[model samples]
Target chain A: MRLLSHNLLQCNVKNCKSNNFPLKIQVDKSNIINCEFRKEPLVKLIPKLDWNALAITVHNLAKNKEFPEKFSPALLDDQKFMQELHRILMETHIIEGALICEGCNKRYPIKNGIPNMILNDEEV
Target chain B: MATRPENICPPEIYYNQDEAVKYTNSTRIIEIQEQLTERCIELLNIPEGEDQLILDIGCGSGLSGAQLSEHNHHWVGIDISRDMLNVAVERESEGDLYEIDMGQGFNFRHGVFDSAISVSALQWLCVASKKSYNPVARLKKFFQSLYNSLRAGGKAVLQFYPDGAQQLEMITTAAMKCGFGGGVVVDYPNSAKAKKLYLVIQAGGDTREQNIV
Candidate 1:
């Protein structure tokens, strides 16, 4: 899964509140799938993003890479910034691993590049 | 298409798209639904002689149903929004359309439908803020109702946004708990638009598996 997606996910398991969102990704394995960048859609999405949270999550996931500390008007207009954003958001894929929710402490297993979220009746 | 009225509803309001571009190029929504439907048909392998009764949950503007109608099958559509249902009703053929909130319950009898489909609607059921209601619980209730409504071999096609790995797992876990056995199909991984995933659940009964192409 991309950090773009990680930013929006929050644990919904029965009032498991407080920092449930932005589930932490423990990457056991990952794969980078090359994807073409689309500028128009990226431009449309910039306004809706949580820039700081995204940067932090990307930093956590990538370790070595550093994203802009802030989203400036100039940065928003810059094509280079968008291209980098696009690469991080669309190109990164977690081929295998688990996304553990901070709130409910549920581990969503990723197999064959797809995350399986199935749970037993007792857990539900 | 005319300019959207000035008194546009808030983002929290379901099916309220102020931007005409969202509606016109809703190709993302349309394409995902088509892919899911095609997959469902392949998986079910419904015989030509048996009557095919299909139910579309949150059948907005009836676009999904319109596509299903091409197969000359019996269908029914239900939606919570009156405006959306009205649009759907106008486009409907022999099928019945009802203004029913799926979060509450489908209000159908057990094994009544041959198949069911919901697309781009579950996320709207979620109450994003304090003033809004949490429809996720209601959604679970709805899925239970759907499980009851389908025949032993019946299938339900649901297309929703995983948001992230956690959300994806949450939804799949919920579906399995609801008794659906199938995997998900990720549509358009690269598009910055709302990335959609199709979850096809087949009710366990007949050994014959339907092929989802």
Candidate 2:
């Protein structure tokens, strides 16, 4: 799934309450495939994004590439800013890797550019 | 009667809080919550014990707590929303309600509960925006607290939603890391939208496998 989707996902087990969300990503391997960037989508997503969280994720995936420190109206309208976001949010794919949750230490695998989030019998 | 919005009851029932509340408050939500609790009680395999202390997380309107209370058990219900708690308090007999943010953590002494249950609450841990809170980290703290709060062998029965099979795996993996021994129960009758499932975790249990690495 997109990091955008990962950022919003939470665990819904009845009472599995502790840090049960955005299950940490443990990317054992990854494949960043190219995808078209859309300015409108990025602009639309700004309101839904956890800016700091997304920035941290982008930085981590981009090998420490820094995202802008602040979010401003100008940045929202800037095509350059939108392009950067477009590249990070949509283009980056986990060809092979896993997303591990720091809270529960769960690993969500990314295979064929898709995350395999299936639990084992012990974890059922 | 005014017509409800078409988008109100989308495929997923949990995405819209208003719709969730409406559904949860409706007769169907109550029945579903009760059934889920019954399933939890069955899974808990609660052995005969007098005065067992139980903690009900996200005890919305006290549906689950009320059912537990009916069994003559000592119950404490907590929720972040006062409005929700108020509804719970009204349904309950009395004196067992607290306004608490589960994401932050429950306010009770360690080793206080014999068992705990949260119904449809874990999903609320995620912040709509990243700036809101690190819900995953918050949830980790919550589980640690639960581990510390429960007497050895105390079981916590919880229900939450996984975005899909992928989300479920991530949670099960996390639960294992927290030293919980159990499995995810995929029992959602409906699957068009997001599916709701249950996880029965035992505290102070042996750590089994290293799945997340």
Which residue runs does candidate 1 get wrong by more than 4 Å? A1-124, B1-12, B16-36, B47-51, B128-132, B187-195, B207-213
Error of 1 at A87 (Å): 58
Residue B136 in candidate 2, Cα distance off native in Å:
2.1
As a TM-score, model 1 comes out at: 0.51
Off by over 4 Å in 2: A1-124, B1-25, B127-130, B188-196, B205-213
Give me candidate 2's TM-score against the actual structure: 0.52
Put down candidate 1 lDDT per residue, B1-213, tens digits, no spaces. 343321134222445533322552479756766766665555556776444668878766667776666675546666655455544434433344544555555434456567888766655544433344354675676778678777777887777655557666766776688887887876677885645577778766644354532
In candidate 2, residue B92 scores what lDDT?
35
Worst 10 residues of 2 chain B by lDDT: B4-13
Candidate 2 lDDT, A1-124, residue by residue in tens: 4565455444433345576654666665654446556465356556655566676676676665658756778887777777777766655544456666655666655543344433442343
Clashes of each: 5, 34
Report the CA-based lDDT of candidate 2 relative to the real structure: 0.60
